[model samples]
Target: MKTSISLNQENLSLIPSDVITPSYDRDKVTTSIVHIGVGNFHRSHEAFYTNELMERYGILDCGICGVGLLDYDRRIYNILKDQDGLYTLITKELDGSLTARVIGSIVEYIFAPENPIAVIEKMANPAIKIISLTITEGGYNLNEATGEFDFSNPVIVEDMKNPMSPKTVFGYLSQALKLRMQRGIPGCTIQSCDNIQGNGDVAKKALTEYIEKTEPELLPWIEENVSFPNSMVDRITPVTVAADIERLKTEFQVEDQWPVVCEPFKQWVIEDQFITGRPEWEKVGAQFVENVIPFENMKLRLLNAGHTVLGMLGALHGYKTIDEAAHDKDFQFFLKAFMNEEVTPTLGNLGNIDLNKYKKSLIDRFQNIYIKDLISRICLESSAKIPIFLLPTIKAQLQGKANITRATFIIAAWCKYNDGVDENGKSYAIEDALSNELIRAAALSHENPIRFLQIRSIFGDLIDNKTFVDAFLSSLKMIREKKIKECVAEINSRLS
Candidate 1:
């Protein structure tokens, strides 16, 4: 038998008292856009924002049809379906306050490979105005060094060959656009909400490059029609666990499948570009900016960069959670000082945003004990994350701004942390794709740290400079000689 949690107008209140009652019409909710990777962050940030907009502004033109490409996601897909696509988002504020709201923006869900043609047809619909993504950093077909599309990947090739809206996110997007073009329907806007810098450009590059290699004729069609809007979306949504569901039901009196619990802080800065049409998300606290570069760069460079510092260090010191990491006085001090003294000074205005206020909020969120975002989650894929998150500050410091000694120390700690052994003297599991290569490269550090730095794929041209190189060497040496605590102190001493 079905899970008995099946929700509909006929069985609206029949939903378990534990289930949330969304004050909206379920029948009129249409699948206007198909989101490719419907993960926790997307559910909390984008879903919550859109639900608020629909309720307040009546912009029902964009009900989301969430999709997952991975087989593991099918279980999650079914759970949401059982709940009538409704879930609760618990926003934990810094002031010991929690707000739980029912999210009903996602109308339906489909696991793509299992229902390939169905996904294609749903996306090919003329009414679908946008195709947004939260497929994470590794999902993109990126050339790590060039930060552009790698056209030669097998998935891209398969997408080029089989072509039922390619199975990968890029393929799905390209194929969906192809169908739209053939049907004479306006193509959907592609918005990426991943942490990768220039996320929209990355999406465009992947889709266009695949089309250029596979079907050259389709390239121009994409350029002239579809829009890939770059965006900066921020919210610290921890990877959900079994207890999160129970907490939502017990505390907020709502049952949620894969419920998203996040810090109160949320941000989505988009480069206002909608091909067919778009939601009035601005009414619901989404900022529409002209350029997303400044916002993206600052957040990645300052907040995320700082998080990596505390994250790796925290994990190395056996601290499991971000709140615990933040409570480390030296770590917290270095983080704040790094942001205020080093990173923030280099950044320009980001959509009239108050940079100081933003930093304060980031710091406050990190202190929320209830959220419990793990350092391990933040520590993954350090190689891809580092160049964008930490390298910019390395470059910025070289430009004669404030002292980036702390930021440079972060870069060094990451190097040693990645290579450094635990008390058992064994290598820590490097979770990144280039883990083996990075470990192998760091081995050459015994010969020369400079040579290790020469890997342009990781650091790019930033490694070439002598000034930053010297700082990196000094910090690395200190980290090796003293402990993590001492290294933090030494960097602080130097910057002071």
Candidate 2:
């Protein structure tokens, strides 16, 4: 029987040699980026790339100093700190192979709830030239209908009152930039790693508006010095549960409190704009392009929208995980047809990307048995996700006069899923910013399907379009009358 070796800086040598440990000296690496929302996605994706750069090219200056803004982040902070800012990254391949490595790009972490000023001071340091974010889609606090920062949010309102001790991401960014300005430190690039389309522009608008309202004097300096470069980042990193941690310990004989488990696919397409220089991430598989918009549109429409469809419709069909749904032949056919027919038409011509191959890769990624990505995780924040990911494709299909049968079915599935009952009549929590409002509307829409489309924030002006309303109603009625799998089979047959 083998005993597990505790993972930490002191025990690096004791860990099994088969597991790839960091080659670069961790002490030699210096912080150059301050990343907010140091969740599993950041660790698995960005940090993994940075770690690879340090190992392969001896780029030690681009070390990451992670900042956790929310109180809940304290747990992750503690886990990473205990391991001396080192963690395990396990990639699960579709063929049932696993690659385990120790990533060491994050040299320090600050739990901002404990010392918000420390986070600000770190960001103000000229050494920290880039402030990246992965605060999720809802973290931006944008008005869904207007596509602008929502100042009416209680948190934003409170942040406006006390900008010195800020609560939200905007508040923290404002204070940090002010400190940097006072010190005459040049502005740093604000990189958004979130899933939102044109994420950098979204961040720019939100941060600029917040500063304009809170500190009018800082607006001119921000406009002159700051840069927000849009980026497209993709990776299927699931939330690490206890089972993942135990698996690392049991299988690999490495004791890790928090280990990130993800599929063996990662892509980051960034706009090549940085104020104070950045890591040569391209060497480590990051793409720096002149414009990330086309890549962004393709990924958001096909991959993200596809995930939403799987989440809503799969849950309705009583599938708990993505792999489970992908295993079902009907669900697989639904995904392929939806992508090939509905989504492909909306995407523009890519230079070299074979869209068909990309769709097939997405299917393979979804079917990775080792990645137990819960459908509920994808289903979370549907109110925010649908508007950003799925709605654009729907609007495009409508404008182009293309067949929207699959898109309409996805919306209907969402509406039905919002009712808080699964296919087996099991009541589950519907997690969303507008859960109550959605549930109320979903209840009414059972009789009048148009009532759900009247959600102006999510549906926008689509409710006024008769064609959209009719298709939505027809799909919703089919879903209500027939089983979810049966409804998918019917849609597939029609498309066939």
Best by TM-score: 2
Expressed as tens digits, the lDDT of each residue in 1-496 for candidate 2 is 7899989999998889879998789989999999999888999899999999999999899999999988899898999999999999999888878788999999999998888788888988989889999988888888777887788999898888877677788988999899889889999999999989899999998898888888889999988888999999999999888988887888889999888998999999999999778899999999999999999999998889888888888899888998898889998898888888888888887889888888889998988888989999999989988887888888898999988888888899989998888989888899888898899999999777788988888887888888888899899999999999999998888888
Per-residue lDDT over 173-225 for candidate 1, one digit per residue giving the tens place of the 0 to 100 score: 66777788887887779889888889998888777876777668778888888
Lowest summed lDDT window (length 10), candidate 2? 158-167
How many residue pairs in model 1 have overlapping backbones?
Answer: 2
Clashes of each: 2, 0
Alpha-carbon runs more than 4 Å astray in model 1: 1-20, 420-428
Best by lDDT: 2
